[model samples]
Target: MPDQAPVRSSALPVSDWQQALDTVLQTPVKARPYSAQIMRQSPTAFLFLIDQSGSMDERTTYRGRVLSKAAAVAQIVNQTLLELALRCQKGDEVRHYYDIALIGYGGLNDEQAVSLWSGAAVGKFFLTPAELAGATLRVDEVTVERNIRGRAVTVTEKRPVWLNAVHNYRTPMKSAICLAESLVGQWLATQQGNDVYPPTVINITDGVATDATADELLACCDRLKALRSMDGNVLLMNIHVSDERGNSILFPARADDLGTDQYARLLYDMSSEMPTPYHADIASLFGLDQRTSYVGMCSNADMDALVKFMNIGTPTQHNHSFTANLSSEP
Candidate 1:
């Protein structure tokens, strides 16, 4: 038989295309978001919206060592990217199971939100695991104490540095979120009918957005969360880091729990509701009551809490299954 040409949307009649779209729009979404398994063919995404405002220059402590908030955040973000890249490694090959983007706001005097990837990945909005690993600017040896056989000892480990400490100008958070929404919408357009897990946007900041009011920022967040894939709507997780030494709110179920702190409550309202799948992990990690609902926002988090919060926001529980599948593949 002669080869038949594939049908293109532009070639279809208006009514036909509209009917097809309506069918897809009416189709029921399967399960909740974040439940889909991340595979090479059906991958997921993570967009880190970092605040590079002048307040980030304040000092903070991590692992008993004092550093600027921007420095600490860069460490946490670099470590997370390293872990993610490692998870996709199968012997000599790295699988492209996830697309990652990093946006740093207020890093320049112009108050623009821009991609933070340096070296070979500069100006790129999204990068696969292999591309990210190859785009390292340089490697640094970090000293840390570890407990081995019940004895604590100092050790040095080599860490890749993808992002540098950037602190300048005021926080243009609204612009950052808007940029993320645009990038995520473009990404989902490529995914189309694929049953991929929804993207997660983790916004880390030390202060309020200077470009927009609280209500305005929340409206931008709502638009970002509205972008979705076949799996579910996108997740917007916010983390407010502070240098103050005191009790921090990790995740609150209700606005009442946030008390009179308008900034904290604003972040809480801007955050997405924690999905049920993550409730168990949050409960086990933070000892929260599993029954209570939680928002994906953290207020006044120190360096330690920031690390843990980032882990929960990034989805990597499927690494074991992904590895198994890789082994079975010839």
Candidate 2:
């Protein structure tokens, strides 16, 4: 039998340790804008962190269909994944244009955020378009009545469900941010000089964190968004699902619009400011006036607005025409 060679360990020489430390500490971080073109040359990451606490059981209306917050969020995530997969498909092949992750927090007793994908998708950090298309366990059919123009129409849709609707204990938002931070750091390390689009994180939650303070949660989110690639710093978006029947607020320029709600203000402060492209897109879609600066935070968003928010975050930069052709697809 051949004997294996012994492993050797090496450390920086005492003579050069000080110089090495000085060089490392003196390095500066450069900030960039989120205007990179997302293409094969610059793949991107889209991460979703969902809160599945007891509050998710609150009922809300989405596009005239009434469902729980958990179910609505699950449906939105699945639909976005399907759209992304379809966007990257050409003649039965899926391009590696983006890496995606969906995480859920607040359901398990451990209070840790975990991958929401089930069956063959467990423990997977990143999935390509093809993998995401094949990652779902089952499909559900849903019917809804919608007013199209001046007439009422019945719409039937096929939806995938990788993660089930779960409503358990309190929310652990900090843990979810920690999980995302690790993933973003790993992703950024892989794209040191590739000019890759920075990772985008979309978090859906209903209430405040139970295990961590608001400041702690914000710090974690700040750390996550601080991760960057050559293109830009990471973008963190927040969607606050509310059971209140009051008017829903979309992207706002200031926390003053959120009133005295501390939770909403915290989320507003934690969110990334939406780039100018988003304002243009939003204006085109809804004919709303453009704001000078919009933060990626929404308070009491309903189903229609939620879907629009997802579309904005999961943009297909080069394939913008794909959805226009499949607008009537079930």
Q: Pick the candidate with the highest TM-score.
A: 1
- Per-candidate TM equals 0.86, 0.81
lDDT for each residue of candidate 2 in 1-330, tens digit (9 for 90 to 100): 111111111133533443443332243444545555666656788898889998899888776678988888877777788878878877777777788988778776437777766656555767777787566878889887899999999999787776677788888888888888876666655554565667889998888888788888888988777666655568899988876788666777888888887777888888998766567776655456777878888887776777877877776534343223222221
Instruction: Kindly report the root-mean-square deviation of model 1 from the true structure over all alpha carbons.
Output: 7.6
Candidate 1 lDDT, 5-29, residue by residue in tens = 1112134455554455444345467
- List the candidate 1 regions with Cα displacement exceeding 4 Å: 1-27, 145-155, 316-330
Residue 303 Cα positional deviation in candidate 1, in Å, after optimal superposition = 1.1
Q: Report the error of model 2 at residue 139, Å.
A: 2.6
lDDT of 1: 0.79
